[model samples]
Target: MGLKSWFSKLFAKRVVQKMYDDAAMAVQHQEQILSYLVDKGVKTEFGRDHHFHAIKSHTDFTQKIPVRDYEGLRNYFDRVVKGETSVLWPGQPVYLSKTSGTTSGAKYIPITKESIPEHISAARNALLSYINNTGNAAFVDGKMIFLQGSPVLDNSKAIPTGRLSGIVAHHVPGYLQKNRMPSFEVNCIEDWETKVDAIVEETLKEDMRLISGIPAWVQMYFEKLIEKTGKKTVAEIFPNFSLLVYGGVNFEPYAARFRELIGKEMPTVELFPASEGFFAFQDRQDDTGLLLNTNAGMYYEFVPQEELDKPHPKTLSLSEVELNVNYALVISSNAGLWRYNIGDLVKFTSLSPFKIRVTGRIKHYTSAFGEHVIAEEVEGALSETLKKDVAAVTEFTLAPQITPESGLPYHEWFIEFNREPKDWNVFIENLDTALQNKNPYYRDLIEGKVLSPLKITLVEKDGFQEFMKKRGKLGGQNKIPRLANDRKIADELKAWSVKTIASSNF
Candidate 1:
């Protein structure tokens, strides 16, 4: 065996051996973690204000602290921004995760000392779990690359602020740092295009075994490598490439295109990490849902998707949750975010190991015409339709076209294709049918003529990329808004589209 392979196998043995033995006793773990959090932060200003000292159980914790979105937690976050010690967590935050302002506005999420290790371990465990399950320790023998945003932090703020991926990059272990490709210098380049070029130049010849990043940005990197080396598939450039790790967006629509770039099917691990916390990961290769970090550093809560739109939603603890119901996720973490609604929606698939699938985002959907369609539904429809037509979708977005004066209101899709459908009309028809079958409200609107049939706008190659560049959001962590409540994105897409495939107006 190679020296690097031997060392990696040894390390993998240790990581997989040190399993969470108490994982089966999830309820006890959940209670103990909650109590620990309450005791640890009971003296903080937020803790005392909410009587954290009195919170003895999950029920008590829920009753004492009302659920809050970002707006509700803004006041505490403001105090943290002003450098107040022990305002939320036990001490001042060590870092602030400046999230991409996709939903509300740009948010500065606190990263306390206690929370740092949690983030690190969650990411580590995700990789280790995959290794344990797939017997793929060879993946770590060569090099791994994470396509991340700039790590350069802005210290002008009360706390150091940067993208979450950038912050995590700074914390990679020394040994892993040696095996990790693309030097930190290239990772901090602020320009997306420039960064991708630098990454390609730096790591093109390395023994790349594992690839990790948002699927969109990784596809860009693969394309660049192919163009530079005159190789049709990434496997031609890096023969040992084996594992693909990705999150931050649904991979279904991009899966076929990405597979084509790689030249063959490879094992891929899905993760559920965000600025709020690293929550879940695909443990077993064939499992559709990710295993929740049940014994990890955070407490989880779920509110029915229906109640989430209300001013005050009803929430359920992990013990009370059921399978198959869509729920908006709420979390209390070591970072001192208490009952904070992180804005992502998820549905439980299994309770034994606490497995879940990310359903959609709380704010990322369309309900303008009472046809409540979500990101999951939209992505699913596109993925299924494209599969039937043997097409590959690169990127897409939906926006409402509500011009009552000329035509009935409808949803317009802006699509960028890696492989166009042989039958264009069949592709659109199948997509519309898929959405209607998946969402009853959407079907009702189509049946009633309350809305026109869905329209497709074929975006030029790199159309979405150009649109993101114009908005200064062309990065790994940023994504085009999937569903807009208004015509803003639709109008902008119309201007950028090379050709428009208009459907008949109602």
Candidate 2:
């Protein structure tokens, strides 16, 4: 890859994109992948004691396995940690992408050898699409700089041992080292104050293109990089850098800030990935949702809301699922999981057996005063209101709580906005309209047919999320619950909102 050829590819991203789109869709090419999982069972049975038995008990086989959470899976994971070969398929795991753990209360998710190829493949597709869009693979001859998790692993004296991060450190092909982060021992999840400084200091040691990670963490990293190097954007470090890939959580929240940090036009890709599987990646580079790994080692299912509320939801197969609708995801992985609810809600924008958007989490809804307000509804309202009012609200969160004094409760909203004073009133009205339209129960609640009235609080300059980030719960799977209708963390947010609102009122 000479500089001339690199420039040609970078400028000819559309051509590269056409090729990736065709290749990704050609799942038939990997028939052995699906066959390997269904026939071999892999380690899919790790969590559920009944996972395999359930698969065998039912004549249909697929219908018997129930979805289990991380806790259910942890029991077997203990054996896996002991390095049980039976737990995982017999393959040398080349890379382990450590993800934040929600089940064991630990932080790193261990990716196995069976998963590395697919993980690399998903990343490649993302890259291919990006190059197609920008024609900039010409910049570094396929070199990319990954801003990754801590590499020190578990033991300081020995090689790093985190499941995911360690995997990347030890297994990422030596041929690919120059394209990697500074070292296998540096930690990106360091304490907030030191984290940005560390990334800048460590980054000074590398010469590369492309960056991948959670957007928020990257945003903070860029801030320090700017301060330390006096460079306004990441582009200044890797002048020809073209792609930014991020997964986990809604990308909408940090979009504006990242744009400001980048200071130039480039493709920012959204990836819909989970520990269970690398489910999807941005298909068109510029498109919002992700392209499903339908042909991967997983059989996908959807559970409708009505059934989800039932003792057991009726399930729909891949061919049976539809679009413009929300459904709980149930996956049967090569690891032998069947009907496992991953607790995510997604809607399809197209019907080509791939490409969909994750609207929100099944557990992240705000239901107060008999009104069920979901992230999707809030997202729609925010976007609709933004376009209609031409406002510039950077971030917003809905927090519903109960007052300890009276059994009665009210809803509180915190928004980081910079619109007109009168537009504030219109913003509230638009908020009401959005709520009413997204869910009917909210409309009745708004009309006083229900309890608690919704109150809006203008969060300080940086907003409540920034404050939450300051408290050490900012990035990666750490979501500020929108409607903690139960007051778990919503109580804390409520207390803060009240203090801010009251102080502002006075």
Candidate 3:
């Protein structure tokens, strides 16, 4: 590494040390933090702002701010999405991280200079943490590949976004070799496409070491790389490859399938990330859950699932949150969000209060046909019903699709599994039974109110998400709806996943 790059790494390490040793305790406490924010109210800079206290009263602080849905933030976000300057701070937004809203069409969230730096440290920590925790410098002698969205925009302008990813790429402390391939996408800027194409094309021509990004997309690239080079395995192609880094979603369901392709227990790191903030990350492949990125930025809050929809339900500041119960996440951050709902549901894995295991999205649900099918309920039912049949949820996208034969709607579960049962019929029946038992709505659906039954789709172990990523329909904050709850959303899922999954008789 160059001298400048080496010192950047050295400096970054010191910063990381300060974060863990100095700021750790303060960040962990939520009550004392309220005092801190109150004290620093309006005085705290953009990076230091709790944001909640910026416009709120001291009385509102303790009363537990009411959680907002789409309607709540519409006016505010609409101003930004309409291309107004100062929507974030002053100037027009530089990049819009396009993503599907929970109950609406895709959204374009804005970011500005002041709020953009929060991700730099996260990007830097990603590198430092890997070295400190894993004690490996595989990149010191090899190339690093980051597979991501359309690197180029439609106008040919560089998408000055990624919120965190852009900062990571442009500000990496001691980046070894920045090698990659053209973003695998269509209909945008020619130059941007060219740049992405250059990266992808060249990566195909050589070896890659530390690799990261949406696992589904990366796997797709590897598939193409194989087709181009006629190589059988990634190890044979990128001999220097050491560790695989993935996040944006759960890796368990795809674990068996990915292992078969990447070749068994290939060291990995599962990351937890969202546009609102980076909560935590996995430091080791074998670790059950990711180490909370409590050090990254912002303070956190959690309210019970039952309380999420309650008017002014009780909210727990970091210190007040309890363990094991599923809670809706709330954030107090530099981004000016105070008690903002990020739409994720999580359960704490420990008493320390710094760790959590993401269960699923709060809105990814179905109650139409009397079955209130939610991510948690479906996850629970699938696990219980398939207890001995299979062990992993690896990856799943549940939706209501029309069956050609039955000429009726049904709840479809697209499953990618390593082993298939000899009697798949009983397994499917039991899965349906489990869902009906967990939620009363499902029973009604079975009784003919819902108009559908359980349909199982066997996928090519590692498919699905790749199809979405190729279409710029994948990311950390994105949710794959469980019910195809509405028309546009349902049609979109049917477009990408339907074509890839195997046909079902049900």
Candidate 4:
């Protein structure tokens, strides 16, 4: 190791030690954060409206505030967007992270001066923890590429606005600026396809070691690299590439394809970051669950998945949660979100250290026949099936086929495969069996004859990519929905398939 690598290792050691110390006291840190937030919140307009002055304990907080999604909190957010001071947080926000929403067009999540540092530090600590665990700091010296959105900010709003990734880009520490790749000019090209081409041009021959992005987009970049250089594998193109950092979606669905693309096993770090807050990260190479950011400037609450739609659902604190139960994650952070429902469902893997694995979105599941199947279950089923079969999938999604042309209603799976399974019948059988084992409701429905066995529709190569492109959500933190309650997306895919078939015939 060089002098810089040596220094990084030393710094990582201290950071990792502190992280362990903090995680060991997860409940205490969360309590402290809650107190601090309430203390500051009492002065804000929202706090006053919610009678924060009289709040004393977590119970009092629950009585005073109701869990709310983005639409529920939009009234306060609108005031903040109009440049109102002390509307939500103590004062005007430093920036607003603009994210796409379903019912709401665009959500502007505040990032206050106090909270922005948490995002930066948590990401830095994730890396430091990896270095401490693996004793691999050599990647720090090589060119690092983060596939993300345009770093350019939109100042038309009261506060500067951009994607969360774009906002964090501006805060890249001065030391790493020299090592970060894809020049600012290339990063600013609003068009993702164009920007990727530019990135391919710039980093085709660089010593890339650390690559970070949403896994699907990173896969697209790898495909482009292979196409340009005729390289059989990404490992062949960048022999120095050592680490991959990914988030926004579960990595298991893409793991097999990634292994095929890289041609070797590589260390990966999974993060749980959102516009609301940076919540968790993989702290150990051997661990599947991400260590929750308990000591950060945020207090957490978990609502049992069954109680989410209730008018007054029960909320559990960090110390009160049970293991392996799906819970809708709620948070009150320094960014001024109070009892905010971020729409993510997570299951605790370890309660002692507060580690969790994201399961799915609260609203992003297929319950068409009353058998609720979530993203985690579907991903798990596919992953389990691949273990026994020689198959690699590019992308996949599930929806209910309520009215088929010639059969009973069943779940329809649209799959784009990198390499088709050697035995299609056996692959489908194994996948269905795994899913049934994971979700008992689905199993009951199948056994009762309410629904037939799931059917798979093979998508042409790049079909999903073209679908995303047509929807104008080609890249930068956008992800395909793993399961849908309705057929809006399924219908669109059907139309795309028709168009693709027609074009091919022509």
Candidate 2 C-alpha error for residue 430, in Å: 2.6
Give the 10-residue window scoring lowest on summed lDDT in candidate 1. Answer: 497-506
Model 2 per-residue lDDT at 473: 64
TM for candidate 2 is: 0.79
| Candidate 3 Cα outliers beyond 4 Å, as residue runs | 1-19, 22-59, 62-65, 80-96, 110-114, 150-168, 174-200, 284-286, 295-297, 369-372, 376-395, 400-410, 415-423, 426-453, 457-479, 482-506
Ranking by TM-score: 4, 1, 2, 3
Q: On residues 5-70, what C-alpha lDDT tens digit does candidate 4 reach at each position?
A: 789999999989999999999999999999999999999999999999999998999999999999
On lDDT, the leading prediction is 4
lDDT of 3 by residue, 1-506 (tens): 54533554565567657655633574444445445544433442321322544435434664544456445656656665565544333445456555566566655445444445656555556566666665565454566666554343333333344433543344344344243322334212233334334555767655577777765556555556666677777777777788787776555445655655665467777677666667776544445555555543365677888887677777776655677788888875545445568888887765442667777787777654545577767767776665546534345667666444545677777765546655666677777878888777678767864465677766554445554455555543333454444444444444434332222434
Q: Which candidate leads in TM-score?
A: 4
Report residue 102 deviation for candidate 1 (angstroms).
3.7
* Tens digit per residue, CA lDDT, model 2, 141-181: 54555555455455431112453433444556554566666
Q: Residue 256 in candidate 4 has what lDDT?
A: 92
Q: Model 1, which residues run further than 4 Å from truth?
A: 7-14, 17-20, 502-506
Model 1: per-residue Cα lDDT over 264-292, one tens digit each: 99899999988888888887788968878
Error of 2 at 202 (Å): 4.6
How many clashing pairs per prediction, in order?
Answer: 0, 20, 20, 0
